[model samples]
Target: MPTYEMGQWLLVMCHRTQQPSPDYLVAAFPTDEIREAYLSIASERAEQEVRHILRAFVGHSRSLGSFDRLQVLSIEALRKEQGREATKNGWSPRFTEYEIRALNHLSGTSSTPTWEGLTWALDLLPHAPQKAIDVIHAYMYAHAQVLPDLRISGLTDAAELIRTRYILQGSASIETLLELILNLDSRDFEYLVAHLYEVLGYDTEVTPAQKDYGKDVIARKINETVFIECKNWQGHVGVKVISDLAGRVSMEQATRGIVIGTSGFTEGPATATEIASRWPSRISLLDGIELIKLMNQHLGSEWHRRVERIIQSERSRQDRRPK
Candidate 1:
């Protein structure tokens, strides 16, 4: 997870399960120890693997120039409807500089949300992301030596200074893709995985509809080849599946193998990972939650555009077909 700071707030990027896009949540901690404590607890409990820092900004106070003055000015125009006062638009005189910083963090450097789109921004204040809030409460309860005197009435913004770049443009499309993935047929899921890896510069092959040799997709890059087993079953994947994937890796002489399961792994499979690790072939397992993270990591700028094009083309093709 990457982090950003503006004045007194710390913004962290988080990707929800099955969602390709990231959401930015801001926090304010009084000391570095407290901040790190929060991160340690969050990382330990996070469902997805959180690594790699993409972009960061630190130690900078947000200024009025950081926001779009024009966008702000336009909000007043929308406050009135047909000559009489109607419902107020999102624009409010109560917006503080810290809130603006939060907005900027979420809006991404390339674009900022219009004032009308900030309906949820202010409400998010004084409460970090749901998970962060939970972790902070737990930390305070422990009363660790780092900040034994620290007390948090509520989440404030973090200001010691750190900020990271966040992309906002494709969030909607990515959400659509996540929904599509969750509802897609098992076959469609395999194809989607193949497509994602292909776009990421891999030479990918989807196995035949018949016997798939324990692997649904095979992706190769340079000398390394990855054999992937896709399991869309709703039940937990047991040791049998992992055992089969381990065998397939040896047969294919691949560099690695990954098991992607929608339901997740039972203790049988999870506990078996250590045994597989002893083999020459490395095996990685990802449940539904982790699968989404992998997709988010692999899919880059071209992803949103590609997803839109594919969806539109599919719709057109269906419309043109005979009834």
Candidate 2:
């Protein structure tokens, strides 16, 4: 038998007899090491996805403000079930039928799935050497977290008990995309700011630092300034947020103020125009996904590592937990 095939046999034994690595035959699952490995892989996968999604979705190299509308579509095909594919405007180039089937555990129909196959592909952490069963088990474990318990407990339509979650539409919330732009997280934020900053050549500092301000963020270089207020809240951000931030802008020795959030401006463009007429060039807006692109552009690979590390750490911790 091939080495990997041999490993599967060993894994099966280990799972049945519930033994550790050396002792293959066991009745219980090796939840600890498996979880750890799964998390490690997941963390790296999240970074890759973030980068891929940003580069692909934030296409045209245009400033986020330029886009008329943004939507995320699934990369997995109609047959793949609930696989949410794109984030912003990103898409996966391809996937096999079997892969798609395995990825659609939560999805009963092949018409449209919710999660993504890529997430399943990344389930195995130290998967350098493994077998189909091993991969399937890991897939089951991951899927079990979201799907009904019967999935892993072995009580569902076995064929439909596939092993993945896919995103159907990956669009960022209209409001939150803005928050990303005003505040600096990485390349995406930096990229947007670089362009905006260059547009007016405005430079001025915010009096209360982001940490001290207890809200929003600001940056400057010359006499001009740009104020940023980031909000991760759901629903539309009302005039209150903008008005309060405006108050802060007055306090800051800056030129312009921008409000950002996943929810975005509560007021429509017309209202925004009216407000802008009242306080022209005083404040602007950006939401979630937009924020990500700007940060990716500005910060680039630097923040990529940070994102990856955060995801990886979270996964690692999840893995270490007892089943």
Q: Of the candidates shown, which would achieve the greatest lDDT relative to the real structure? A: 1
My TM-score estimates for the predictions, one after another, are 0.42, 0.31
For candidate 2, the lDDT comes to 0.40
User: Over the stretch 138-256, how does candidate 2's per-residue lDDT look in tens digits?
Assistant: 55566553433322432111111111101111233323334433344433333333333332344312223335362333456667567766555656666676776667777865677
Report the C-alpha lDDT of model 1 over 1-323, residue by residue, as the tens digit: 53434222322233222222243322234346645654444323322212111112111222234234443444334323412432344433444433454445445642432221211322321212232333434444542322212112222221111110011122334445456566766766777777667656787777766888889888889998998888887677777777888887887688988888777676643554454555644788877656655454445323444654544443454345454
User: Model 1, which residues run further than 4 Å from truth?
Assistant: 1-180, 268-275, 300-323
Worst 10 residues of 2 by lDDT: 159-168
Off by over 4 Å in 2: 1-215, 251-253, 269-277, 301-305, 308-323
Each model's total of backbone clashes:
21, 77
Indicate the residue-level lDDT of 84 in model 1: 46
